[model samples]
Target: MFDHVVFGVSDYAASKAFFLKALEPLGVMLVSEGPLGIELCRPDSQSSLCIRRVEAKATHLHLAFTAESRGQVEAFYRAALEAGGEDNGAPGLRPQYHANYYAAFVIGPDGHNIEAVCHQAEG
Candidate 1:
């Protein structure tokens, strides 16, 4: 539905590090970095998420990324916690959303809700 999204953060370095670790499990990596911002992209090289340094306080936003499998969702949660993210929701199947809606959520360094979701049915 969207091409890309940018998040404004107060502490660029910290937010960058947090995202780098958290998104690693999803195969998202740093595509570009500059004084003002850093961009992360999937293996396809399409920039999907970006974090920009801002003078104003960062605003909280809910962002969700698609995961290829349930294991990736779990890995994202573990990586996010290891990178200093606060737990919002543990990895599990959200039957309320759908039968195969497995997901995990965390609050990032900038206080934004970050999520990884897998829609595939259990094998």
Candidate 2:
């Protein structure tokens, strides 16, 4: 629903690195970077996420990525935690949301609730 989302991160380098590792399984790649910030997006998508280096108080944001499959969700969770993200939720079915709402959540360096979810039923 968003063309792109922009936010400021206090630790630009760390945040950028964390996201690069965490979202790799989701096919998100660095689209561009400059002295001030960087942008990332999936190879097959047009939506982008931008993070800027700024002097501001710590803020929290929830960003969810669409995973193509439950395996991708699992891979994303493992990669995210390996990248230094704190586990907010493990990969599993969230029947509360739907029958096949497999997803995972991680706390990013900037304390954002990052999630990857797949809506398709198991094959």
Q: After superposition, how far is residue 20 of candidate 2 from its true place, in Å?
A: 0.4
Tens digits of lDDT, candidate 1, 55-108: 888977999999999999999999999999999999999999999999999999
Per-residue error (Å), model 1, residue 68: 0.3
Query: How does model 1 score by TM-score?
Result: 0.95
Off by over 4 Å in 1: 45-47
CA error at residue 63 for candidate 1, angstroms: 0.6
Q: Summing lDDT over every window of 10 consecutive residues in candidate 1, give the lowest-scoring window.
A: 43-52
Off by over 4 Å in 2: none
Residue 31 shift from truth in candidate 2, angstroms: 0.9
